[model samples]
Target: MNTIDLQVPHVIWWKDPALRNLYLAMPVLMLAATINGYDGSLLNGLQTMDSWQNYFGNPSGSRLGLFTAIMNLGGFSALPFAPYIADFFGRRIGTALGIMIMILGIILQVAPGVTSNMFIGGRFLVGFGSNISIGAAPLLIMELAYPQHRGKLTTLYNTLWYVGSIIAAWTVYGTIKYSGSVAWRVPVALQALMPFIQLIGVFFLPESPRWLCSKGRYTEAMAILVKYHANGNPDSDFVLAEFAEIQETLRLERESAKLGWAIFLKTPGNRRRLLLIVLTSFFSQCSGNGLVSYYLHDILSSVGITNTTDQSLFNGGLQIWSWLVSICFSVCLVDRLGRKTLFLIAGVGMLVTFSIWTGCSAAYSQTGNTGAGSAVLAMIFLFYGVAGFAWPGLTVGYSSEILPYGIRAKGLSLCLGITALSGVLNQYVNPIGLAHLAWKFYFVYIVILVIEVLCIWFLFVETKGPTLEEIGRLFDGHETQYVESEEDKA
Candidate 1:
C-alpha cells in the first residue's frame, strides 16, 4: 500500500564524453528501427501513390492487402531463428546480415512492371532483414548503455521507428510528383540509402561488452566496459562494479542450465518475466496499431476521400506528427515519467481515441456522412500521439531489461517474435476485415485496448532507475544485484 517514487539516474550527461561516445551507437541502431518503420509504412504510403500502383499493376482490394500484410510474415518467419543468429554468431554479425538481406530486397523491389514475384519476394526479404536488425539492435543498445540512462536510450529505438516512417512517408509523398514507373521506383530505391549507412556503420562501433563477456572474451569486454563506463579509467568503481555484475549474471546463467528454450521455462522468476513479456508484446500489436500503421490510406479511402494527393498529405503529416510526439515522449517522459505510469496514462487516452474512432466510423458506415468519416480520420493522429507515448519503444525496452543474461537474447526474441506473429494476424486479418466489416473492425481493438489497459494497471512494475542486473534481482531469488547509488535517490 506504500508509494513507488521512481528515482532519477545517477549519471550526469554533459560532463561525460565517454558515456556520450558509447551512446553514439544508439543512432546507428535507430536506423534499424527506421528501416523497420519505413517498411511497415512503405506499402501503404506507396499504395496511396498512384504512380507506384500503376507500375506495380495497381493492386487493389485483397491483393493489395496481401502485399502489405505479407511483410509481417517475413518478420514472423525470421523471429525464431534471429535470436539464435544474434546469440551464436553475435549481435553485430546478425545486424550486418539483416542489412545485407534488406539490400537484396531493395534491388528486387525496383523492377519494372507488376513484377509480382519480385514484389512478394522483395517484401518478404525486407521483413526478414528488418526483424533481425530491429531485434538485435536494441539488445546491443541495452547491453552497452549505462544503467542510469538505459531506459531513455533503449526506448528511443521506437522513436527512430517514426523517424523511418516519416522518411518513407515524405519520400513517397514528395516523389508522388514523378510520373510513370519512375515515381514509385525512385522512392523504393531510396529505401536502400540509410540502412546501407547503418550496414557500414555497425563495424565502427563496439560490440555489446556483456555479449563479449558471455562468450569469454573478457579482455575485449573489459576494454569496452572501461572505455564506456569508466571513461578510460579501468580502476573506476562504477566500471568495475558494472563489469563484475555482468560477469556474475553470466556465471549464474552458466551454472543453472545450458542456453536454450528450457532455461526460460524452468526458472520461476524467469517464468514470470517471460509471461509478462509475452503479454506486453501481445498488447503492443493487438491494441489496433496495425490498423492505422499499415492501412491508414485504406481507412481514409473508406470515408470516400479517394484522391491520392489528399491521402499522401494526411499520411505524411501523421508520420511526422507521430515521429515528433514519440521523440518528445522518449526524450522527455520515458525516464522522467517511468515506464508503467506512462503506459497506464496513455492507455486511457488511446482507449478514448479508439472508442471514438469506432463510433465515428460506424456512424459514417450507416449515415455515409463525410463529416463523421473525417472525424474518424482525424482521430488517427490523436491515437498516434497517445500510443506513441505509451508503448512504442518502451514496451520492447522493458521486455529486454527484465530478462536474465542467460536467455536475454532469446527472451527478447521471444517477446518480439510474439509481437511479430501478432502483427501477422493484424496484417492478414485486418485487410479482410476492412474489405468486409468496414467500421466494425474498430470494435475488436476497442475491446482489446480495454483489456490492455487493465493489464498495465495490474501487472506492470516500475522499471526506472535500476540497473538491468538489479532488475533481474526483483524477479529471481538472487541476492540484490546492482543497487543504485545513494546519490541517484536524490
Candidate 2:
C-alpha cells in the first residue's frame, strides 16, 4: 500500500516554527492515554500491596471485581453524552471539562480513611471523566494533524498508555517500601498529574478546523490550515486542495446526516463500518489481555512465582517492554506494515503465544515442573508484546479515521462505549474465573483468540493511503473533486 500522498507539498516539521510548536503541544492531548494506563496499572499494583489489602480489608471475589470494574461502568455511563460535548462544544472545552472531573475523583480516592464504597465512587468518577476527555482528545489530534503526517501522529497517540503504565508500575513499586496508607495513597493522588498537565495544555491547542467549518467558520478554519499545515502560505496548492476536500466531504456528510440515527446502518458500506467498529472495540479488550493487564499477581501465583517484590518487578519490566515495542510499531511500522497486516500479526501471534501459555500452565499443574512454570512467565511477556503491536496503538486511531466527519464523534463514542462495556465484563469475570478454575481458565481465552484471528482475517480492511476525508471513498464510494491550478501541477 502507498504511504500518505507524496505529491502533496511537504515541510520539514522541525524546521518550521509554527509546525514545530504545534507538534510540541500534542503531548498534552496524549495524556488522556497516560491517565488510562496509570489507572489500570495502579489497580493491578494495589492488589499486591499489604497496606492496600489491609486497608480495604482484603477484597476478593465480587468485592474485588467491583473495585476494578466500576471505573468502566462509570465510563459506560458517560458514553452517550460524550459525543454531544465533543461535537457541540468543541474538542478543547470538552477536554478541559473532563480533566476537572478527574481531579475531583483523585481527591476522593486519596482522602483520609476512605471507605471501600467511597473508593469505588472515586473510581467511577475517574472512569466517567476519563471517557469524556479520551473521546475528544484523539479527535483533536487526528483533525489537527497535517495531512502528510496524520496517520503517524494519531497512531502515536495511544502509545502513551504504556508511558503512563510504566510510571504507575514503578511508582507503586517504590511506595511499597513505605509502611502505611501513604504508600498506596501517593500513587492514587498522583493520578491527577497527567490531567493537570492536560488542563494547562488544552488552552493552547487550536480547535479542529473541520469542526470550525461545520459551524460555518470557513475563513477561520482555512486560516488555521494555512498557518500550521502550510506554514502561512496562502497560495500553497496543498493547503487549497486540502481545504477544498474538507469542504466537499463535509457537504456530502451533511446531506447524509439528514438520515438521523439510521446513518450508521442505512447503507452496505455503513453496515461494514459498524461491524469493524464493534469487532475492533471488542477484540481490543477481550483478546486475553485482561488476564495479564489487571491480574498479574494472580497469574504469577499460578506459575509458582509468589514473591511480592518479584511480581512488582515483572509488572514494571512488562510495562517498559510494551512501551518500547509500541513506539517502534507506531513510529516505524504502522503505515509500512498496513493496518490489516498488523492486526493479523497481533491476532495470530497472540493465539500462538497464549496457547503455549495455557499449555505451560497445565504442564506446571500436572508435573510440578519448574521449567513448565518458567515457560508460563515467558508466555506472559510474549502475549503482551504481541498485543502492544496493535491493541494499544491502532484500536482508537483506526476506529476514528474510518468514519466521515459528520459522525466521527459519534462513531468514536460507540467505540469507547463498547470498549468500556467489554472491559467491565472482563474485569468482573476474570477474577472469579481465575478463583474458581485456576489454570483451566486459560482454555476460555484460547478459544476466544481463535475466533479473533478468524474475524480479523476475513473482515479487517486496509486503510493505508487516503487522507482522513478521502477515506470515505473506501467505504461509501464518496467522490471528491479537487481542481488544481496549472502552477500546482508543475
Model 2, 1-490: lDDT tens digits are: 1112325766688998878999999999999988878988898899999999999999988888899999989989988889889988889999988889889988999888799888999999999999999989999998888777778888899899888989999999999878889989999999999999999989898999988988999999999999998888899888887787677657665665566556787677677888999999989889998878888889999889888888889999999998888888755688898888888889999999999998999998899899999999898889888887888799898998788777788888888888889999999999999999998988888888999999999998789877664576687664322212234345
Tell me model 1's lDDT, rounded to 2 decimals: 0.78
**Number of the top candidate by TM-score?**
2
Question: How many collisions per candidate?
Answer: 0, 0
lDDT of 1 at 328: 80
Across 379-430, the per-residue lDDT of candidate 1 in tens digits comes to 8888888887866777778888787666777777787678878877777788
Model 2, runs deviating above 4 Å: 1-7, 478-490
Q: After superposition, how far is residue 113 of candidate 2 from its true place, in Å?
A: 2.5
